[model samples]
Each structure stands twice: as C-alpha cells, then as structure tokens.
Target: MNSLFLISSAIIIFAIAYVTYGAWLSKQWGVDPSRETPAHTMNDGVDYVPASAPVLLGHHFASIAGAGPIVGPIVAAIFGWIPVMLWIIIGGIFFGGVQDYGSLFASIRHDGKSIGQIIEVNIGKTGKRLFAIFAWLTLLLVVAAFVNIVANTFVSVPQAATASTLFILLAVFFGFAVYRRGVPLAIGSIIGVALLFACIWAGMKFPLVLSKNTWIILLLGYIFVASVTPVWILLQPRDYLNSYLLYAMIAGAVLGLLMYRPEIQLAAFSGFNVGGKYMFPMLFVTVACGAISGFHSLVGSGTSSKQIDKESDAKLIGYGGMLVECVLAVIALITAAYIGGDKLKELLSNGGPINVFSDGVGTFMTRIGIPLEVGKPFTALAISAFALTSLDTATRLARFIFQEFFEDKTKEKQSILVTNRYLSTAITVGLGGLLAVVGWQKVWPLFGSANQLLAALALLALGAWLANVGRNYKMIILPMIFMFIVTLTALVQLIIANIKTNNFILVLFGVLLFVLALVLIKQSYKVLSGSERKGMKA
Candidate 1:
C-alpha cells in the first residue's frame, strides 16, 4: 500500500468527522455562542484571562499533543498498522474527540472548574475529592515521565537540548513582549519565530551537553519556577509559540508523505500478540494519547476551559485539536511501517521511542531532499518542544489540583499556607521529581494505565454533567463505557505484571487506580441508571 493512500484516507475521514459528526455533536450539546465563558467573566489577567480562538486552540493543542501521539502510535505499531491506524482514526473521532469536547463544555458550564469539581456538582464532594487525588497522581506520573524523557533527550542529543533551552528562553521573552510591553501578537510571534530558528541554528553550532541526572535536576527546578509563575508569563504565550513549530512539523511530514508516497513495508497485522502482551487491552493503553488519552481531559477541563473565549469555541479547540493529533499519530504509524518492524525494534533498543520517531521523520524529510543532518535536529527539536511544553502544563495543572484539593480545608482552618501558589507548586514538583528518579522504568506502563483510567473517569464526570443539563448524552455514555472497560483491563494487566516482577510501588499504584475507577464507575452507574439521578437533581 502506498503511504499517500493511507494519508489521503485519514485526511478524508478526519474531514468527515469534523464536518458531520463534530457538527452533530455541537448541535446536540447546544453550543451557544452568546453564553458568557468563564474566561471573560472571570478575567484576572492571569489564569482566567480570555483568549481568542486561535490562541486558545494553539495552547490547548500544544499541551495535549505532546510526545504521546508520536510515541504511542509508533510503539503500538508492533501490533500492526491496521490495528494502530483503525484505533487512531476511530477512537480519536468517536472517543477522544467527544471526551475532550465534552470535558471542555462541562468545565465551561461550571465556572471553568476541573472535571473533579464537575464531579462534585453532579455526584458529591467525596467523589470529587477522590477523583482529584487520582488526577493529581496521574499528572504526577506525567510530569515524571516527561521530565525524564526530556532530560534523556538532552543528554543523548545535545543539539536538541540546546534548541529546547533556547525555545524556553525565547518563549519567556515572547510572553513578556506581548503581555507586559504591549507588543502586538503578530510582531511578537514573528520575532519569536525568527529567534526560534536562530536557536535551532545556535543549538547545532553550540550544543549544551549535560548528563541525564543533571538535566533532570535542572528540569525540575525549571518546572517549579514555570508552574508557580503566572500563566501569562510563561505557560500560555510559550505554548502558543511552540504550537506553531509543532504545526509546521506536522505540515512538513504530511507534505513529505505526499511527495514520497512510499510503499508500506511493515506487516498489516502482527497477529493478536505483541511483546508478550495481548493485543486487546495493551494496544489500547499503548496507543493512548494517539487515540483516546485521559490526559487530554485534564488539559481540556483543567487549563483550556479557563481560556476559551466562547462556549462554541470548545468544539473547535477541543474536538478539532484532537483530530489533528490523530493525524500526527497516523503519520507516526506510517513512519514505523516504512522503517519496518525489525528496524523499529532495533531503534527502540538503541535509542528509544523518541529516536524512532525522529529518525523515521528525518528519513521521510530526507526523501524530499532535506539533508539528514538538518532533518534530524529539526525532528528532535520538534519532539523536545512538544515534551517541554507539556511538562510545564502538566506541572501547572498538578498545582491547580493541589490547590483545589486544599481550598476548602484551608478556608475552614483559616490557614493560607496550604493553598499558597508557591507551596502547592513546590509540593507538586517535588513529588514528581522523586517519582521520576525511581519510577523511570515503571512510569510508562503505569502512566498509560493511569492516564486512560483518568480519561474513563473524566468521561463519566462529563456524562453526569450532560445528564444534569438534560442534553442527549448517549454519545458521552457510550465512550464512557468503552474507556472504562479498556482502562480496567490495562490496570489489571499492570497489576499482574508488577506483582510478578516484585515492583511493589507500581503494584500499589495500579491497585489504587483500579479502586478509584471502581468508585467513579459506581457513582456514574447510579446517575446513569436513574437510581442516583433524582438525588442529583437540581
């Protein structure tokens, strides 16, 4: 099969999903443009400031589209291209898109609160607290995995590290230029872009090499500062800027696919077993962010919801953003397929998933006459940028959850310390840093399960919210059920795997996630089955 055929097919399917299915969903959910968004009503020139459609979409997409789409699809392609492609398209549209859109819509309706808070309104406070803890832990895993991954990249690929460091500093400058000095966004963006390319050039010329452990410590310090700082200072403007780089990378890869139109050399199906794990559940977990990540729900509800300018914009920023990510995942699967299975396994053994994607994308770029030297650093820079942006976002989100968890208690106790912004950020980053040290090997499997489980729980929260609003919620409910089952299977697998390997910490974490899922499921079932619906009635 020609790569162009697959690429074209994915493009057609995504368009149809956006136009027909996405529109139908928007209509079904009764998206009202005139409704006041929390961003506008709660504007504080900080976390709650309203943003234009494009800016919000860029930040949202950049936050959620991290390494997951690239890493997940390529890793799971071991099961075969057919399964991975089908999941990325079908699951992305029907599951991930709905979850993102629904979570954003629900959060907007609830004063830009997180899914945890939404659960409190629909279920109860205890349920919300439980969900909040789960969210915080999962986000911790995200921070740990991402920090280690970024640090490893910096250690192994010094030019990428140099480029990433430049990206961060320029992002801060961009933020200050636009928000503080009142520079026009267009001018600031142009300056930022120019500086970005210069950074790439400089990175190649004067690479900043560091050991992995040193990089990890420095990254943790950076996260602490980034998280505690106001959103406008670093998170939003930086993410918006990095988002453009990500968009360019995607566009270039798509063009390469069209220009090269290489034949698929990988097997279409690799039976029902891959790397000693059964295909049914492992594939779903492995291909998580590429298909239906729970992490996205956190981002959509936790951060993006606060910045949306209008209710209707949620559909575009949330649903549309996810479909674009699905396209990237498709491109990743194609990269693996073109590289062939044995070569991919070798790449995994030698350099890891990041190397696999960079090498594959670099190879494609080479096919189109771009030299490997240029393509390699460019691809690495893109991936590192993706991870770095996600790192701060996740750190910030974890801070939010910590503050939210302690808000009422602190108020009741008349204590300002627990909810202090700096304190919360410090605690969050500290825990994540600790886990990143010991949980390096354990984070991926555990993170995948926890993340998907979070998604299932988030869907249930959204489903409950939809029910409260008296909207047609079958769309929300079906995906909720599917994710619930898939996540449960993953948790069970991890529990068994961890126990056999004597990894008690991961085993405990897996069991805790399973229990939390059960609790959320019970709450959702009661609401959906009408038994608990009357109690939640407004």
Candidate 2:
C-alpha cells in the first residue's frame, strides 16, 4: 500500500510497453521511414510546419494531458483506487495508446487530415459528416468544461493566473526567437525553461487577482486568438515550453514519493454502487483521459500529425505520450488515496480534484525540502497551464471540424464562412463560451459520455480503414466494441438523469449524440463487411 511501490511499478510497466507493444504496432501498420510525411510534402508554414520529434511530443503530450489524467482519476476515486488504478494501466496501454497511435498514423497517411476527414476517405462522405458533427459537439463540451476549470483555478489561486500569463508572453518570444530569429533550439529551450521558473517566482511575488467571470471572458478571448494564429507563434511553442513545467512537477513528485513513501489511506474497494452511481459504466466514463479518451485522437490527428517530421515519430508522440499520461494518472490516484476519506471529501467539495492533487503533491514536496506554500501553487500553476493548452487546442480542432463539415469537394472555391478562419473560430469559441457559464459540474457527465463515444467512433473509423486496406485490424476490434458499449450505456444513463433533473439542454445533446453514433456505426459496418467479402474472393 505504499505510494512508491505503486508509482514505480507503473513506470516500469509503461516503459516496457513503449518499446515492445508500441514498436510492434508501428511494424504491423507498415510505418515507412522512407516515405515523406505531410509536414514535409505539404509544408505550409502555418499549420503544416515540420517539427523535431521532441518538440512535437511536447505539443502532443501537453494538449492531450490537460487536466484529464489528474481530474478524471481523482474524481473517479469514489469507486476506490483499485478499480481506477487497474483501468489506468490496462486501458491506457491497449485502448488509449492504440487509438492515439492509429489515429495519428492514419492522419499522416491521408495528408494530415482530422479523424473526420480520415473517415470520409475510408468509410464515405456521409460517415465523415456524421463523425464531424459528433466530434465538434464533443469538443464544445471540452472547451466549456476546461474553460470553467481554468477560470476557477485562476480565481482561487491568483498567483497561478499571474504565472500563466507570464508563460504565454514568454512562449511568444520563444517561438519568434527559435523559429524565426535563428536562435538554436537547445540554447533557446534552456533560456525558455529558466525564465519559465522565474515566471512562477514572479507570480508569487505579484499575484493577478480577478473574478471567475472576468477570467472566463479573458480566457475565451485568448483562445479565439490562439485558434487562428500560426501554430509556431503560439500553440506549438506555448505547449512545448509548458511541457517543462509538467516534466518538473512529475519529476519532483516522483522524487518526493520515493523519499516520503506515504501509505495508501483509502480502502481498496468502495463498492460497486456508491452515491446512487453504478460503477459499471460510470467508472469507465469517469476515468477517461488516463485510460482512454476520444479527445486524444483529435489532438493526434488534428494537430500533431500535421507537424510530424516523419512516420517514425508518430509512435513516440502518440503511444508513448499516452503511457506518460498513465503515469500522471497513477500519481493522481495515489494523491487521493494518501489523503484518506474525510480530507478528500472536504477538498473535493471546496476546491475540487485539482486542490486535492495540489495539496497531496505539496505535502510530498516537503520531503524534498520544498515548502508547501510554493509547491502547492506550482502544481496548481502547472495543471492550469495544461488546461489552458487544451482549451486553445480544442478551439483549433473544433474550427477544423466546423470548416471540414461545410467543405464540398465538388466546389472549386469554398464559401467565406468555411474559408475565413476568424469566422469559424469565433463561432466555435462563442458557443463554448455560452456553455462555460453553465459550470463544469453540470457539463462533466455528459462530456465524459460523449468524449468516450467519440473514442468508439474513432476506433470504428480506424478498424474500417485497416480492414479496407487488408492490414491486420484484429487489434482494433475489441477496444472499439468495448468503448461502444461503455459509452452508449453512459449516454443512456445521462439522458435519464438529465430528464429527471429537468435539464433539457443536456438531454437533447445526449440524444443527438446517441443517434449520431448509431448511424455512423451502421455506415462503418458496411465498409468492414464489404472488405471482408473482397478479401474472401481474392
């Protein structure tokens, strides 16, 4: 029941999986090192710029990690650390990693298209449209939920707000210097990280206090600009720099846990039914990002695939990135388990899971000679930074989906609404802003269900594509089927719960997403069946 044992075990398992299972997947999917990737062939300095493996990994990991691995595991701890831990390790390797890896690989092959566009190529145009609608709607939920979470964090921890602002300004300069001014990456990175730490110290000295609503407004405006700007100027560099904060936090936590070795205070199992929620589907849905998420596929296909220098980097950024998140999820579970029952409840009620994680990690840092005052705020700042990363990344991806939805291949010139980047981004962020005021608590359950369902659809698309190409698609079958059942069940429960509470808006969305899933599944099934028949004849 020692925390060190649990965390160390997870690290070892993930490391082994990265080399063995991850490499095996690359080979099975026919990763061609000699082939030119979209980043090189379609090199537009805007979204399609090529990046080294490390830079893309940082961007990919930061965008996908967000508050997901931390929030989901801590929140789902109501079902006990045992079930949550099992899912993080098992589900992360087989379900999440494969989906992320496959999605990225698939996108690069199809000219750096989003998963929805990939669906269009492999399944059909109708399948692509349906998937795009579902994916965009799910992204809206992501924008709303994370916007609320980050705004609240800024309100409660003003120093983190100050630090995050500094991080943004620093990233802009770093991007210009490294990408435009010909500053060497290694030296630029050294200066960037050093100044990043200074931002934290300066944040503590001069906190930027603001109301939650005010922060929400400012954040919406920030993502609007972030979504339309060139990736190298903001998105890529910001994520790359912010990644160091996470790396330091993780390293510090592991070092502290090794030295401190706190005992697991929570019970192994808290029963299948706790607080009128059944663990069957709720547990699977709640522990999403840590285990598997539909969202990661978006980050992989939507952004990272566009910047990849070669096909070889996809496995590292996709599969290896997911395993790294599983490590963070394990650390999050331990933080909750170490806090025991009463304090965990109090923290959840007051500041939510982020507070619980911050406090636990703050205590861990004490063993390594860091004070709680500094350590806790630093953890808060790191997490909020990533949440902000997800916010803007989601906005960009949503814009991509929205534009893709309106795209007509038959037309030579697209409409302004679709071609105009600002208009599309404004529409996406504006809708998400309206929902941000609804609060994350009201939106999380439906988001979880829809997010998982998105994963199922992505898996379905991957399966159909592999089968169509006569590749070995058996690896994708079980995860795709399991996600469909889990997410569909979760959506049903959410609909019933929303109706009882008289929340018709969420109920409507839940029903719409459900219908969309069924229709897409039917479309994909035909493709799979036809491919099987073709193979039999050949």
- Candidate 1 regions off by >4 Å? 409-414, 534-538
All models: lDDT? 0.85, 0.90
Error of 1 at 132 (Å): 1.0
lDDT of 1 by residue, 1-538 (tens): 8889998999899989999999999898889999999998998776797877877887899999998998898888878899999999989999999999889988898888899989988987889999999899888888888898889878877998888888778878888888789998888878888888888899889989889999999999999998877677777887888888888878888888888888999999998977687888889888989989888988988889999999889889999999999998998888888878588789889877777777877777877788877886798888888898899899988988887776674345734535478888888898999989985566566788788888888888888877776778899777778778888988888888889999888888889888888887887787877667743321
Q: Residue by residue across 41-121, what tens digits does model 2's lDDT show?
A: 999888898998988899999999988899899989989889999999999999999999999998998889999998888
Look at candidate 2 and give me any clashing residue pairs.
none
Listed in order, each prediction's TM-score against the native is 0.96, 0.97
Judging by TM-score against the true structure, name the best candidate. Answer: 2
Question: Weakest 10 consecutive residues, lDDT, candidate 2?
Answer: 529-538
Best by lDDT: 2
Q: TM-score of predicted model 2?
A: 0.97
Query: Where does the lowest 10-residue lDDT sum fall in candidate 1?
Result: 409-418
- Candidate 2 clashes: the total is 0
